[model samples]
Target: MVLGGDFNTSRPELLAPIAQIARECDGRSYAPGDASQEVTHYTYVTAPGPAYGTYTSSKLDYLYSTDDFTGCDSWTQKADQADYRATTVPTGVSDHAPLYGYTCGGPRLSWDMHGSVDGVVADCSAYDNNGSTLGAVEWSAADGGAAVFGGTGHLATPTPPVDSRLSLSVTAWVKIAANAPTGAIAALDGSRISGFILWYEADGATWRFGMPVADADGWNVDRVIPTVPAVAGKWTHLVATYDAVSGQMALYADGALLGTAQHTSVWKAAGAFTVGRDLVNGRPNAFFHGSIRDVRLYDYPLAPAQAADPTL
Candidate 1:
């Protein structure tokens, strides 16, 4: 159901065979940031020995799938990642960057966090629901100007991002304070409780993504705490996903699935969406103490491949 390789040509005429197959067999091409054409750049240089020779600048690699998929990601960022990086051709790992997508639904919201922090933080997604800063959150130069949370600062949207009753996925680039003990990364607030909370637990020094079964709950939380311990002073790409249909949740760190657990007890937490902070028992708690950037929210759960991107 999947086809992939370097065709050595970017011309439309030469790729007609794959296009014809797509039309005849209900398949479609999957380019990293586009849906209509193959667009992985040809970064190969015909020279050697630290030569900045003329580099090819056209699409030369491609992938097509007969199975339905949602969001696409390019291997163009880090040594590893839980989500796609903003740039292409990550640290010259290869002459041509890899292109791949996941079997999930379309994205609903995102914040690149590369905008001004003095004014309203713009939402990069199509929703147009801008964000505002809470407390004394300042901007850091990391990841093209990320929001730095100092125990009690964060970014908040006017309304909730998604209905927690449905399947959902969230990604964020986080680097905890070297001296800080623990903190929360992201959440959707509610009057009585937050929908879900992805935070750092100091007990095991692990990343815990927790979801309560009901709105008015006890201590019943299906928490997916990965076995890997978090490292401070460096950015960690974290992704947490919940598939409502399967009643399962997964957590990924640095482009790898760490763990999964059953968590079907879902409730819609209706309130403003907040980053770098979490709301527990209808109150403010677990203020993140670090820098957060490139926060994204998807309305659908991401598959294992869409998350374990090797390019970071």
Candidate 2:
């Protein structure tokens, strides 16, 4: 269900097999970033026998998955602690340490704007320099009769009373208009206001999620669920959920699981929340350029069926 490698090239040839497996299993590939960004760099370091000469480095690890199996819940590249003078290691076997397991879990799902909106509050009475606006809109008649977000706009609201529970899922039925600028994100932030944030971005067509890293200062973390360009002007389902016990975060596109991350108790009770843009800076820089509907948030992480099930 899971495959990883260090493909030296950035073309499909290196990733085609992984993609095939995902397609056959009804799953998808989850890379940290797209090929265009060239996040996958190849390098290695050779220290001069404690003499401390120039060290070599390379990017050689990648994670892939089949459609039947949900992708990894979390992943990380290893670095030398001693090289950075952060810690001491007994053996200097290799410049790069082997990849290690950090966290694990299946994909999670929840509704963002489903059912009653009693406890939810929307703050859209403002506009930014990019002509982006935020406000709550009712779902259109064509969209399964759910009162979802309307217009090519973005908005942020506080987690309603119904979402006070610890572990929960969030789902949104979204449509990105044709030729919309990339770098758009739809996210949910923890109560810390600065600690942990879970978000998805349509980076020029590739979909990615931003997650937290352990023991790292600031919000240093990884991005998962890398893929080809997302079709413009089409309805797609995006879901993210966290299991407090397992400390896993999963991302689902449409009805298929894409990627997962591992973490423990990432979400705290901070009472801070946002959508459409990165809220850490308190601005709408990466604004979403599409229509969102059926935004639902739940108190518990939804099962795969609950997330992809149309009946819900």
Candidate 3:
């Protein structure tokens, strides 16, 4: 998607340039009308200063998206109160009004483990236009009580999201209190374990996303991302996706693509799907020493923009 705050799409000269870009990218404007009543850009015709006077409202700002954006369900432009120059007191907050687009059809499992003071189980608010219980996970509080897990504080769902027939994507928000030598973020382990983990080398200065692949040698295939700077004490959003159709695996950190590799293995998780630790041979290992929240899983690979947009 491409967005402009002060694009001035009302004029042919300015709109021509944006139109060229939209054509090259195969995108369309959010509002496809040519009327000043659809105006987002407001101005004053009788203001005190020359710079602020002799101007009429016009639709200037725009949002354009590609053809693959199939879930654009609605668009709303703020038309009242602070959105316009007339309704605001002492003018307005900005020359342009706010615009919003709503979408649907994402996330097979969403665990917004919030609103809990302290608990041993994290509830899964699991829904995907269709609803079912992914089940609550068992998690013990870590020592010092900041949600750190040192091989002890782990969680598991009775039903796993892994299936050999579907593509997969996982996303999480994590805050690392102190860097671990190595850690597990989430895993689906049974007789043969396969999942996303992180290895922090260089004495906690760097970290990498590790995906253990199931192979003939029994989980010997390891795909590792290049080490990145470990920013401790800050929240970072991580996204990892595996496309069964494309045979591609990608890892992202803080909305930026880190690396990609081919992964053709079919995932059939039976033992348990877990978080905060990895289960190898049906035991917890590589426990994460951090706080995890907003962990989501999907049956389809997410677009890079969707994965990166935290609001979605």
- For TM-score, the strongest prediction is 1
Sum up the clashes in candidate 3.
Answer: 0
Give per-residue CA lDDT, model 1, range 243-270, as digits (tens): 7766788999988888999886667888
Q: Relative to the unseen true structure, what is the C-alpha lDDT of residue 208 in candidate 3, on a scale of 0 to 100? A: 54
lDDT of each: 0.72, 0.47, 0.54
Q: Report clashes for each candidate as comma-separated counts.
A: 2, 36, 0
- Regarding lDDT, does 1 or 3 come out ahead? 1
Of 1 and 2, the candidate ahead on TM-score is 1
Error at 49, model 1, angstroms? 86
Model 2: residues with Cα > 4 Å off, grouped in runs = 1-153, 158-165, 182-185, 190-204, 213-219, 265-269
The CA root-mean-square deviation of candidate 3, after full C-alpha superposition on the true structure, stands at 15.0
The candidates, ranked best first by lDDT, are 1, 3, 2
Per-candidate TM-scores read 0.66, 0.47, 0.55
Could you tell me the C-alpha RMSD of candidate 2 in Å?
A: 15.2
Per-residue lDDT over 1-312 for candidate 3, one digit per residue giving the tens place of the 0 to 100 score: 544355656664556665565421113222222122245666656555654434466666555533232212111243322322444353444556764333324565666644233443444545422122222323324321223445456666666665533466777776665645466766665554545444334353554554555512244544645557768767777787766656677777778887777755554555556667665654566677767667777665677887788743
